[model samples]
Target: MIQGAGTVILWSATIERQADRPLAEVWDNLDAVWRRFNDHEWLSGKAHGHAHRVDGYARHTALTVNEQGWHPHFHTLLVVSRNMPREQAVRLAADIAARWVDAAEHVGVVASTEGQRIGLPAVALPTDSPHQARRQAHREAVARVQYASHQAWGHPGSIAGTPEGVFRAAAAGDADALDLWHEIEEATHSHRLRSVGGIFRTPAAPRR
Candidate 1:
């Protein structure tokens, strides 16, 4: 059974100078920044697992590029377990923002929200759904994939595999799979991944 729902803490920061750099470069930089935030001691304590016991935590980072010339900042979504209180979660998120803002002069922390709210479509639950039936089935599927993928790859598996990794994995022989993956990835990149209570919620409502 799932213990708790997940919450996403979204964050962003702007850069002053618009460097004519590839999107990959900007993504790498943003990943590095969040990695540092995740590795901090005080923040790690709030993480879910044992690996987060010290200065490291298992958190996912999504990087988005605003080509609309919206300051060239990044949108970050940090997944936290649902059991955490809102105030505590917000406080921890704020700590991360402060550190990132201080690390780079041009990068100033932007707004932070509890979950991904815009662009992505909402998932509709069946009106007559039986209690625990839908959630249980979803949890089982998620556990299976998480276990299998983690064993296959050294890293812990995301509830849904990373869109980039999924796309690359499927691009060789399945054009259809590639196209489908691309669409989902693009949506996630634009809207940010939202988390529902269970693990296997649709990509539209990712677990953070």
Candidate 2:
């Protein structure tokens, strides 16, 4: 398991879904923002100097259909230095949120800062657990927060935002839901549902 400060900083936002826009087009827009933020803004040191504070990060994507149309968003978990102060972490979160909004605009999606959420790390992993147990606890922590991961339904806030709910709606003969399911499947056919970068990325194997 990757090491961290035992805290997870979450950053998420969605593009405004339009009724007339194809889901593939909308997905491409959001995907572009994600790529730009990760490449040019966050890791590239183009905007802020907080990139060094990040120890590692993971990203998960999910899609849902609503009255507004297709709602797709990214759930990014950033693990910062263990010694980072709360105030610094808060500033880092705010910076990331701002960059997210900027990234959206560059992609022609006018996203609001209010829609971007900066979830602070509220829980700390136990310090006394064995190595294996500690790894399990870390997985549980991530699974609990990223409900889209489909690892666990530990939170009971909303189901319509999950893939399971999309399928349920399709089963119920909801046309919008069916369309969303099909479109998302085609849009993300060769894409990864979850990704890791920074220090979380495994180093390339050496040639023999």
Candidate 3:
């Protein structure tokens, strides 16, 4: 997870109907897409500039390929820096979508996390029949919050321009917020304070 006040973009695509192609071929295509993203000059420049000014923003992305026995697709999650204007975010997302669509006609890409409503899974309390029920309950509570964060934010990363929302969501048991805070803290490991538990432990202060 990447921690910052930015947006996350998700790009996904289903495999084509070329049933005769080997699995390696599919992977190769996906790899090419990944390489293309890495090679994008705009991405590199924005990432470098953001990192230089923001103290902790940099390149944080996850690429994965899922294979459901003949039903294959790829998912990429990208986290950008904070304070970026929504227009710029939309433009960047559009550019990436255009690139992917150009490469694969069947690819389906969308940008979310802004004004979109998402449902979270039901909260599950830890088992009560164990001697370590208290600890288990704490862990379960954390997990519930994390899951909600992922669903609402599109990734387990920090959100920009929505600090209050992020804090509220996390306080409401969004586990991804904790994960994002942890990632941010880990990235700034040189700092004396290692834990972000205090930063997010309570609900965000009311906006002025």
Candidate 4:
């Protein structure tokens, strides 16, 4: 994420789960998408979960829900041990999107259109500062917070439910909001918000 961190490569790509696969549907059946992704070896990884040794080829992947017009696509950020070729990166993103489409079809939901189009993959992007990557992360966090805050969205439980207003307050130098964010962030936490895999994920870690 810094100017130079040869040990890690940060990149991002957004792919939709197909129009037919609505967030509501995925929300209702979390397994429909998450489970299959977990089982599939779309990426070359010998390990799963985050407990793997840091030296292993670990990737931290987060799922984002875009409450857009008709389709609610997912945004993913991948931090891999090696810098993947742009072509392969695009393919990986495309393949994941296809997998989601297949998951929907498996559930008897057919999309009218093809799977989501793969956006150009950003490779070796800087994330430590005010780069696009950082902005994207903020947007994802904000969206996750918004989606979870409104229970009407039907999210099972919010892992990112810490009031975003508190974040803003904290940024404004409000010590109370900063303290509250830390308290709620720990208390409201549940499951892992992101998926970790690839050789970077050590096999020694407990299986999910």
Give the top-scoring candidate (TM-score): 2
Total colliding residue pairs, candidate 4: 4
TM-score of each: 0.34, 0.75, 0.37, 0.37
The 10-residue segment with the lowest total lDDT in model 1? 116-125
Question: lDDT of all predictions, in order shown?
Answer: 0.40, 0.67, 0.39, 0.41
Q: Model 2, 76-95: lDDT tens per residue?
A: 77765354566666776787
Q: List the residue pairs that clash in candidate 3.
A: 5-82, 5-160, 6-160, 145-173, 145-174, 145-175, 146-174, 146-175, 146-176
Over 1-208, each residue of candidate 4 has an lDDT whose tens digit, in order, gives 2123212322222234433443344333443454555453544443543321122222223333223312223333344433445555555556656766666556554432244433332223334655445434433443433343233234435433235555777778989667655644553354343445543232475679
Query: lDDT winner among the candidates?
Result: 2
User: How much does each candidate deviate from the true structure in C-alpha RMSD?
Assistant: 14.0, 5.0, 18.3, 12.9
Q: What does candidate 1's lDDT look like per residue over 10-82, in tens digits?
A: 3444333335544344444444444454453344454444321222122233332223311234533233333
Q: 1 or 4, which is superior by TM-score?
A: 4
Number of backbone collisions per candidate: 0, 0, 9, 4
Query: Against the correct fold, how does model 3 do in TM-score?
Result: 0.37
What C-alpha lDDT does candidate 1 achieve relative to the native structure?
A: 0.40
Question: lDDT of model 3 at residue 166?
Answer: 40
